[model samples]
Target: MNKNPVDAALILVFLYPLLKGFLFKFSSKNMKSDIEEIGGYISFIIGVILGTYLTKKIFMIHQDGVYAKIYNNIPEQIISALESKPLLIYVLVMPIIIFLIYKVVQIIIDLINSITLYPLLDSIEDLLKGKSGFVKRIIGLLFQLPKGVCYVILLALVLNVLVIIGVNDTYNKKLNESKLYGNICKNIINPITNSKLAKKIPNVINDSFKIVIKNSEDQPGNESGKTIVYYNGITLSEGIKSNEEIDSFSRELVKNKKTSKEKAKIIYNWIGQNIEYDYDKVDKILDNDFTIKSGAINTFNTKKGICFDYSCLYSAMCKANNIKVRIVTGEGFNGSNWVSHAWNEVYISEENKWINVDTTFYKGGNYFDSSIFKLDHKDRKIAG
Candidate 1:
């Protein structure tokens, strides 16, 4: 009844002779001697196999079960390293497998000898005694050393495998994010930072239209009736209510602002701090609706968008702050090449001029200069 399989197997080997004696005594006198002899050999062989296989399985289960607990409690950083090196896993685990197999085979052979009453061992009780026994002991010692090494290796391997899957997912995410940051720096700010004499070009127009423009930064102009809208049972007078989030954001920024200059700076800084340029959306401008209705809301919520989204959202915020801003689209340099782009023009009360504010450029860092704003921001069609 010993639950330990190794001990039970050893006991069964010794007790087999007594059990066989009782069985042979109760057998019929007419039974063939060959039939009894064949049965004994067959039973011994079967017992050796079953005991070896079950003991191996039980030992493996117990070993892995303990390792599973250790694997769970290990630090995530170590887990990540282990997963990246699969060879380390093999080195750590293979030894344990070898040792377990060796022990299982050894125990099974002992069981076979006890059950079969093999003549080789029973004929000389001390065949494995004296110097012969000493040699056997030396062999056992050599195997035990390797067995220990194998167990250590396999334990390490199991723990490493347990932690790798999660590590791989986290690594992929960071790698993708790094690529995005690198792309943004390469695309948005690299052009203006490297540009020279772009300011001296006479074609960089300050004003195109013949009409006189006025500084409406604090004008509170009602030229557009859509400035005031009611939401949640409250009347709000904000020009840039392009979407609920933008509207809410505008209100929070300029709630107690006294002047248009302060409000404009707040909106400019907010857009510069929040939105990221959508490099992918630049190619799909014709297909995607990059207007205030959908674009501004999406940009504000997602924190990423093309120049169109940046301009649209900025225009909306300007309107809510009672400062008229335009989403201007035209051809501009984006790094080493000129491409179609969108930016903003906000009317300043102090300067009495329309100043370009590219939130996408500003988000790159504090690297963008206001003096050279018109160098790359070409004026095209304007949208309120």
Candidate 2:
């Protein structure tokens, strides 16, 4: 009188016909065609089976005992299991499930066509031709596929809703399960760190740093020039340190090299080598500012640009290095109050100064003179 074996076997067989027929009927009505009806039915059955299996597997891994331990106890166990499995398993399984579901639907369509629809079509036509008694029977049978599919779908939906409502406790347990949570995290984190996407990080970081420095150099004039140009908008602080990009760059510089001064020197040289001053380009100003990353990338790719290009390149490079950097804009020499200019100020820890490093003039190897650093180059604005 063992009930377990009998119950399990009966459940499996009963489910096969009940699910298959229900899905077939539901699909027929909704799809209004035999092919779609068969496909829908098979798809529905496969989906339910796979979904049930997954839910069971998850439940087994987490839930313990009949009276189901408190919610906390179940999730704690499941989380512990996921950490031990390799990431590939998760990646491989998802596609397989999708394929299986598709195959199941295909098989079901073939079975329905061969066993039911072909034999029934002749009778259906005879009834339509006015063969009284046979006509009623054929006509009724003709609507069977569509009606069946609808019934199946409705039943399946109702059952699913019931399970969701009834198994609230189990669902809650699964949600809080550590293994489930861990799996979610692993799925998100592993791809980012180990995939091709991670390779782009270094380039992004490097470019950001280069642009910041380049933008700083594009600012016009020496300290005394009548056009006291600002980089982006802010007047260059006497040693240049004010924003996040420069500060972060300063830290990275110290970490990567012997001193902040050495890092600053490399950044300074990069700007000087990359940016060039263009007077004709300045006259046709359109936009007041440009982004460093896009500017540097474009300039490097095209080999031609204006001060805005330099400013954008320098700002982006500094950003890549996690430095606090900004593009400043203000008045320049010759009473041209609207003459656009760009520059940067980087923080140097050893000197405890935000030094102004003009890559444009610095590239020209002009001697550094404090006399050229004029205070009249007022800060008009700032952008990062």
Which model scores highest in TM-score? 1
Report the lDDT tens digits of candidate 1 across residue range 65-169: 655565566587755654454333324443344445556655665576546644432333344345454455443343233233333223322322232222343
**What are the per-residue Cα lDDT tens digits for candidate 2 across 219-296?**
465443334433333233311332454445435544666655566566656556654554333433323343322245
lDDT, candidate 1, at 334: 40
Compute the lDDT for candidate 2: 0.41
Q: Rate the local accuracy (lDDT) of all candidates.
A: 0.46, 0.41
What would the TM-score be for candidate 1 when compared with the true structure? Answer: 0.36
Best by lDDT: 1
Identify the runs in model 1 with alpha carbons over 4 angstroms from their true place.
1-241, 283-294, 364-369
